[model samples]
Target: MVVQESGTPRELEHHLRPSTVKGIDFDQLLEPLAATAHGAANKRPITGVSLNPQIVQPGDVFLAISGAKRHGAEFLDTAIANGAVALITDEAGLNLLAEPASIPVAVVSDVRKIAARAASMVYGTAKNCPELLAVTGTNGKTTTTFMIRAITEALGLHAGLVGTIEMSARGQIIPSVLTTPEATQLHGVLARMNEQEISTVAMEVSSHSLSYGRVDGLQFAVSGYTNLTQDHLDLHGSMEDYFQTKAQLFTSGHSQRAVVMVDDSYGQRLAQNASIPTESLSLDAHTNADWHVVNIAPSVLGHQFTIVHRDGREIHARTGLPGLFNVANAALATVMVLASGVALEQLQEALKQADPLSVSVPGRMQVIGESPVAVVDFAHNSDAIAKALESMRVTGQGRRIIVFGATGDRDKTKRPDMGAVAARHADIVIVTDDDPHGEDPEPIREQVAAGAQAVIDAERAAVQLFNIAPRAKAVEFAVSLAGVQDAILVAGRGHEVSQDVAGIDVELDDRVELANALKLHGFVTIY
Candidate 1:
């Protein structure tokens, strides 16, 4: 007998305001948008928002946003031909002459920002369904968001995930390029989740997304802070600016609560200054933290720990994820899950029934070998590099070598910092290429080399440092240097299957290459 797949009923179309010939006062909203558009109009009218030309129905407003290498407004004619009732754009877009059309064009200043606000107004329905919880930090945002989704699902609620890895709404997974999607796409996803009865949204709010106004009008019920480290400086200009951008989600608009992990200085600062009530978490750190992790021990499998919430309430838990730092990340996730109204009993039961959470966090201290242990991680910053190295040093009984590189066109200031951390922590260090996009590989390597050299010159540190570019070669060399008892940690790229060079993505899996390099050296594993 044939079986049919189960599916939900289709939802109705989105709500759109009717268009009227009598122009309305575009005064309150578009004044800033109009000034940026260089268009003077107090009575300009707009009907609806439409980004896609092919799907644009009659009496809809067509928007043209500037893309990486092109402008979205270039497709204005296509949108019009497809039945756009009104045009929403800046002066450059309005100036594009087309045959006399019957539609009215509403010119706004700061088109991107205005479009975001407009889209949220048009499509945002977070209030009608489950509360939206926004998670923002330099690190742990992805893991925390996914963990919250797990806990929410354990409580039998439909939870949606939006982050760097992928998006999950009502059991459908879609790949994403940006950590936080464009306002139009984000609102559209949330609206679909709302329709599908997925009440809770756990989203990663990136610094770039916050500064660019991607989540302009999102009404987050609670916002969590994991911690801040040196990252994304190329976009934010300074660490202060980057922290301020991340803080926007916790303090801005309609965020009601701030769940912060105060182990980092920035997290503590955010909690102290938060407008809303804040819950703080720390792992053996001396702080007036509201939530804390204690009784920690590491096993070959993972770490076990107990989390103490406010009022001395404690839950014994063990995560399959590795390292002590991850325990802190788990604590942040746990606190947020509890704050989401999941009962303590449900949280404890879910922790027990769910698959061990360790070895599940991607590129996070993932071990691939035993004798000559090979680990892969996405630790690109100084603190993260330090944590990964420390974890390896303690976990590995013998020599520990680290292979890593600083990413090009991104926070170059951290190159030396990362090098210093690696050199000081590991027994051997290999500085290699990491996405030297559009930058000279030698200079990038030289910067990291200087950092390692600085650490070596200052003190005869544990790690012997070397530099090699064209990342694959460095990995090959690092593997060759390893012995039976030595571990080689390939850092910076973890579970990343591609290498980006001068703006081109090339297939390069560090883990696979590491294994191949081991095979070339006649090292075979018996599991």
Candidate 2:
């Protein structure tokens, strides 16, 4: 089917639900698999499916997938009591059910691989669901998705967005716990968007999602790559493995076409090795690319740039989002729109009229104050922290002071790298607690502080370091030290509302705390 134009329906809704599952038999569906099941013949039909035992309802098939903590099959009794009509899991999970006859058990070897498609069968795909556009990268995924939504809406189309911040559609927004939801919830969200008459959607596809089978079996009309940096090594083990996992989205099964930003080596290789039709975008003038950005002007209000395609079409774009990196992000979003079948001319016109800064994703280079400039961003990685600090330095005149921290139990190796970046870039560095999930907050801070101390002592840099465990106090201290010409950057948790400390979500907002600190110091900001 051709991509639908703004205000035009591409196709009529065939069925409200994508599939007919009046009473899908469990045994029949599992018959093709080699999994051994003693009660295969006795399994009954199921009306729905769920992986989490906590949310299982009547007639739902509780999918007991194995996991690191404990096999999901361990929760079989919990699922059965919650009205699960049948169980679809591996041979191990089937063995967990003490009384297999209480509920039908059908074994599947690979639960993660089949969970998404199973959802597609039960809930049915949304009617006239918007063409799926997936964006994957180390950063900019959230910003780009929000950008696509802005550009799409500017064209008089209702577009839905699913990302780290929220899952929004039908005039409703829900806070998100994960960057990308698991397969069942992800498809359910997509179907919900379809029902809401959203003709287009932009979803942030995470590397973890790709590797864990979260995005398995979903179709994407177009997918995109922003850039890969050194983060998530804890989960993937090595940078090469991380890159390969991100590269999987560019293949035919996950996406139909790819729009890749070739500014980095990983991106360049991705463009070269992409299995599907690909479009190359670049910010550098000397590089050979299909989409080229030639000019960038950064101001206190943000930046403006120009983009030229291989067809000789040049378009002007502007963003209130500070930093030259945003120019790359805006350019990436521009091509994504074109790849989705929007007329390039239409997109160009929208860029001309739309306020790109107004489309900013929260906690992403979020400016909370101006005089003694205060900024908050989700720059937890070393590379991202460096870029964010540099972006803030150039935005306003004067010395830079950074308030940042590394999370616990996730990619511990990046902690020192982040500290070193802050030490080198900021005149003053405040090391604070980020998200110390289950681990003692002290060790994480010490590792990061050691990196900062190392850099400071190595160069005999005048950068002063303060180890502050309480994030709120850290913001206050930074604000107390800031002058009118200085910028205070609070990194790590951009839009996050709470601090994850020892497995508990402690309520803390950098923006709120920063604002309060500024107010306490009798300082007024341009914000």
Candidate 3:
């Protein structure tokens, strides 16, 4: 697979840790390990924590977890060579270690479970963590977190963000490697935010993070659920498994309260069964939710809507981003802040004055052109593709044109579904390569194209389909074929800067490619 790194191993290691750390007693930090201590390990102070042996540094406790291919004890020598002072691992890892090891060792039954707690103790984040607000689901996690950060900022609070696109602490942005970072990096980032005096944090909690104990030690002030759909089946194996993984974030252990969207069955089930005080939100006024959206009308910015509470409270809001889904995201953000104890009157004032919901999220319905209106979005899955295309529908003579492709080596079952969604929504569909990591590009394209072709043949649909490789050419072709009144959507890999093709990184940014193509086609380009 094409492995993308944010930086060199050493640089990334340094970047993940906070600049300043208060050393903690190793024995005290090991209290949460829940295992007997072995070896000649003393109660020395530890300055940092890391799970990666390549990034281990002096005074750091290295966590060795077993992997599918190899045990982490295999890298014990490398971690020690890089200056790891102590080791935390399972019995399997301890058994693999050589006799008479130099450093101290602690053996746990499950390393992943206690890794976050240990890191939190070492980084001093468990007690000093900022007001944490989190969102988890198949989609809308990133946008909702961004919206939460925006609203928090509008209220004159310094807010930090951790999500799919990037992580930020008081406006210092760092490109993120995962939707939710590993426990070591997560605690370190939280420590840094605390050091910077950031009062609130909006983070996207992914299913993988929840399932893997990445967020084990975090107790969110408020957590939210958007919706679950057919994405990441490769990881979870089934939709039910994916739902359960996301459900972990809403329990009393993980969050104090919850704001759940009951528009879908999964959401409905979650809200009903969540082991915490939960507030239900729905676009349907008749759904009997704690919060309901009404008076949705298109505006110059986007759609203006009103959030109505069951207790006769009302807040008017608007989002600059298009689509009904964005409206849901904005409403979710508003209620999450309200749940965090922001007064309704104060939040309404902030919405009226600052319009925090109007903030633009990177690569999410990001507009690159005014004429032949072009957009770059991260809509790789079937549900997201349908929503994106529906939102970009043209009026009168304008046609909806879409250029997208399936991500390789990920949920191969969704490829055909994504194509079918495109064929049903767009008048023209151009299938291109998107991150063909370790998988042949052509076979992936054929599967997607086959789905589109099936729809065209079965229903006699008047949809035009094209299979193009090397995404840049596909974008160019879409722009060339579009009319001034048409709208073109370059979907999938929204803000990603590089394409993974058979273990090689081919540089490509959708916004830049789309903007360049629009200019080449004599169309008006937007920033």
Candidate 4:
């Protein structure tokens, strides 16, 4: 049920012109090239895309983006060596391109959106795609995006997904490195999806992508919001800034119908303020939303819930996933399908009988094999941490041993808050490492320790507190401390396979370590 629009085909070649580059666009939007001028080829029509220079094929465009710690364009020589035809860059990369290379260099006004639009045009825009739905918010965005993709495919639609965990089509698997990719990469992905005859795409829309113009130019048939929380304060500067970025997806005129979860105030505000007609969902009764969940019940098996639309349409839904939070996620997915014009009866059947999706959303809430339920979840922010800890507490039959760490260089303010929550909730607190980046491990440990200490009674603080600066060592020590009757929670580095220490990514996984530790302790159970 895509909203039919009368328009010309959106073209990539049409938007890649040199005349439209803006400074702010260059600073915030464009992806800087990873290639250096040392080996750049002559400017030509790019038929392919690559971030890495070595893998760049001839006649392909090389995108140089400034990443979390370094500029991507610093690898221009490598890009040129592999046969890059053109370059999309920002002002800073001009110095690198001082001497002309073989390729045509186009300075973009805003790299993010421009690149996305360019890729769409080159790869084939919304016209080529069956339909596109972008899911945005602070938490559960990745899960909801994947859920929608799963439901779509389950209903016999060929679906493609792009989110934090991975990217996939009917038959190929590509590991996901970013929650949302750059404009060119995104467009290229859609292009590939079009080639695969994928009728739909469900993707996560990060605040960074919206603010940086990473998702510009393409129109979304249905765009949905999960919930906003206290994450990414380091980049957005404040909660208001974060909300504004998320709001852009609904209001920036890219989406047709907005599906928002009005469980929180932010979602309520978005529903009331959005330009398009919004489908609002609620986990609790306060929202009085367009799409509402009633008779909600949670159990160890999963969630049994009912969805009520404003027109008296009802859907009795169930999901294998646990927690009340996931109900909101499921409801959001249901509404996205409804918004896309799937029949209510179909939505109900899909909800009730959809096969248990084999999605390994790395850190969402990964269960480590053992009794007492050792779990690893990617709950770094205060809101997510609180939710993860509480979910673990409610689901388990024994005392909880929570192990976590705050990143070294991120929003330092959240450290104490996270510590306070962990201290008040968990029976045991094992403070550990999570991507210290350039910051010293000790200070990060101290900050989290300070947080936990602030909430704990002074008399018991010393006994409950333990610090292990390196993540693997911290996990090892924590795992050793747990017994079969106690649940050990390894939070923060949920699905990640590496730890960034002193600028190098070192291998580490909570699941792998926990498995070995369980086997080492000589615990055997087929269950």
Candidate 5:
């Protein structure tokens, strides 16, 4: 039974974004798993696939897989109630079900492996698209993916993008919840990309997505490894596990080839052990790599560097994104484009002429002002915050004022570390909220402030502490403190449009608020 509601074409697209397929035999679909389909609704024709119970429709199959915090078996009843034609789940979920289920069930030993395959069959295979480029790492995944899309577009090719900030195919873009989308949405986005005539796609593949089976069955044309760092320990438990999860992208069946940045020890290990053919990349010109950035110039406008190729040829490249880290990001993107089979001469020339603003990632080191310089960056972790502050410190001959906060319900250990980093690098540190999620904002701020207070006696001294509840007020407070030659750093929640207060994402854009503050302070007239 199809439920049709009258609406505009745009409304219809949002509702029916996931393409539906039918006429496939329900039991036959489970042949891939060798599981017997049993229930009152065994022979129903499947029309679509879904993971979330609320989104399941008539003739849709639900995959009840385990998660980091909870088991999907708990939601079996919800899924069945939401018109799930059948359930494709592990033995644990099967045990949760009674002997006679309201719907058919496909019991599998590994639900992750089949979930994406089933999604692909219902919508379409994303592999049929022209090219799929996946970039994975702790940082720079979003920036690099945007770069790939920009470079491809400059070369007169239509490109699609999927990453931390948003998902875009053609001209349409939507804010992203995960660095990599869920398996169902990932395949659906790929299908939409093909429909929109997007020739090339660059996506971010996060460790959580890889570990949680969110990107189970998708293959990439070429995967680029950005440097991994110490983060996400609450989920991965250890740095070794984090590195291994990232390495999955470079394995035999995942990517065709790899462009590994050997700037860090982990990258060195990944390049050496990559199952597929790999090319080593480096930001340090002296480091031996197939591609390296030498003769670098870092400015307020970003870095201008010459990329030395394997043949000793140099490509003069410049990105307006700023910082030395961005040079590495641009270089990695250059190699990824090369791995995609774009002609070397074309890529080199295009890179030399690449407009930084065209590929500018929204919140990663975005400068919103000129005089009394202010910057907004998504430097949530300790290392990232330190790097952002240091980058600004090196560039400006001024006092650095920092406004940032720790995300609630995340790695609690990094709280003090972030505080220590801010206290060490920033002249003035203002602690505020960054996505409190389900945790109390006050306690989260205290942990970060405690860390900062331990390292430096800023509370009683020059470093200012403001217990601002609302994020916009924090930005206003930081702006108020800005004097001549003083550069302010707004860390955490870069390019993010909402602040996760309590449980809901209240509309709060850093750039929007920062730009407003800059304008009020008479820093920039045109936002």
Candidate 6:
């Protein structure tokens, strides 16, 4: 599927608005924007809202904000030609408008925030939204949100999901371009979910979404924190700034309650300073957290563990996905739902009957073969890469092989660390290209290889390293070199089907490539 352009309204053509929202007075729908503007007399009813000028429809209120490269007001002609009835913009945007504007314009200090508030009002999500659950972190956000949705469904309630992989309302599944949708599209999804009688929603809230005001004007019923690490420093610039951006979600304005994992220092700090009522979770039994995971044992699929509360209560649960991190994900999902007001006993029974925690999350520790144990995951960062490789380790003489690469135009600082982690964990490491968006792929691969080479030299390890290209060849090489007992991991790109290379779109799916490579080697694949 073609990835939609950023900020484009998606999955809203036929399902977003109900008949009741056919028209709403501009002043009523966007009172916040009108209250601060100069010419606000246009009282035309707004039937829709849009941020992208290309998708503007008749009777829509176009939101024009100041962008990094160009102001949204620069596209006023396009928005008007496409049928925008009114406009909401900042002073900078207002200055760009002609003296006699074709449409009524409302100026706001922050157009993005106003757009979210206006969308909420227009879509009836400001007051009638479903039980909102959100998870935010550097890693595990996707899996935790997916687990929340699974648990919600296991309890026999309709659930909607908006995350990195896809957005779903009722049965309509739309491919996701952003980890969190733009506010206008987000409110539209919530409204559609409300219309579909979905009682709950699970969403992945990225740091970019929170920093860019994509999740503004929304309140989550229960928000969750997994862990924060060295990633996204490209945008945030520093770890402190990144943590502060994520910290915004734990405040009273964003969520009513929170379930925070106190494993990392960031989570510990967030739990200590969070404004809302927060519940602490930890895998360490010694820590006096509200919830704890104990009695963990390896299972055929993954691991089974008990989620024990400090108040002498516990629920048994299991996950089909491997890795101790997945066990943390399952425990976090359980507590997040529990914090949302579900009875412990009822949740336990639903978990037992449905096995919701075992639900497959696309591209996340996704296993494709049994012999040689081929797997694909989205472990791009150092911490995630370390954990992923550790989880794939077996007791005997099975060599662990990893095929991975760092993304270009991202936090370049993490590239070496990711390589070092792979070298430390795997017997053989294959460095390859992973979506070198707008950057030269060779340098990116070299930097990663340099890190791995440093580790091999310093430790005098017996690990073999190879730098490959185009990704498909890397997977093929890994499979060819693997024995029946050895494991192969294709990391960095998981469920993604396309690669962005130097502004060009290239078709690629790691799972498909790995499966084909295994089949060519006469190895049995799980699928």
Best of the candidates, TM-score: 3
* lDDT digits (tens) for residues 1-527 of candidate 6: 32332333533443445435656887675565554545646667887789988877778889998888999999999999988888888888889977757778777788787778888878878888889999999999999999999999899999988999988866667777799988887887788788788899999999999988888888999999999999999999999999999999999989999999999989989999999999999998777688999999998859999998888899999998999999999999999999999998899999999999999989999999978888999998999999998888454688999999999888899888888888999999999999999899999999999999999999847999999987999999999999888988899999999999989889999999999999999999985
Candidate 3, 454-520: lDDT as tens digits: 8888864789999998899999999999988899999998889999988988999999999999999
Q: Candidate 4 local accuracy as lDDT?
A: 0.72
Among all windows of 10 consecutive residues in model 1, the one with the lowest summed lDDT is 9-18
Instruction: Kindly indicate the candidate among 1 and 5 with the higher TM-score.
Output: 5
Model 6 vs. true fold: TM: 0.96
Query: Candidate 6 — which residues are off by over 4 angstroms?
Result: 1-22, 34-43
- Would you list the clashing residue pairs of candidate 6? none
TM-score of each: 0.85, 0.91, 0.96, 0.84, 0.89, 0.96
Best by lDDT: 3
Clashing pairs in 3: none
Q: All predictions: root-mean-square deviation over Cα?
A: 5.8, 5.6, 2.8, 7.7, 4.2, 2.5
Which lDDT tens digits does candidate 1 get at residues 1-527? 21222222111113211212222334443454553423344333443456666556554566776668766677777777866655677666666645433455566655777766665555544344357888888777777787778767766778888888677776666655688876766776677677777878889999888888888767787888877888888888888988888877777575878788888789889988887878888885477898888888875646888888769788777776666777777777778877767778878888777732442555666666666877788887888888876766433367778899988877788888888888888878899998888888788888988988988988755558888867888888988988877877899877688988988999998878887888878776421
Q: Per-residue lDDT for 370-397 in model 2, tens only?
A: 7777888888898788888888753354
Each prediction's whole-model lDDT (CA): 0.72, 0.80, 0.89, 0.72, 0.79, 0.88
Q: Deviation in angstroms for 516 in model 6?
A: 0.4
- Residue-pair clashes per prediction, in order, are 7, 2, 0, 33, 1, 0
lDDT of 5 at 359: 71
- The ten-residue window of minimal lDDT in model 6 covers 2-11
Clashing pairs in 1: 33-108, 33-109, 34-109, 37-109, 130-199, 320-358, 321-358
lDDT rank order: 3, 6, 2, 5, 1, 4
Query: In model 1, how large is the Cα lDDT of residue 124?
Result: 41
* Candidate 3, residue 52: how far the Cα is off, in Å: 0.3
On a 0 to 1 TM-score scale, where does candidate 5 land against the true structure?
0.89
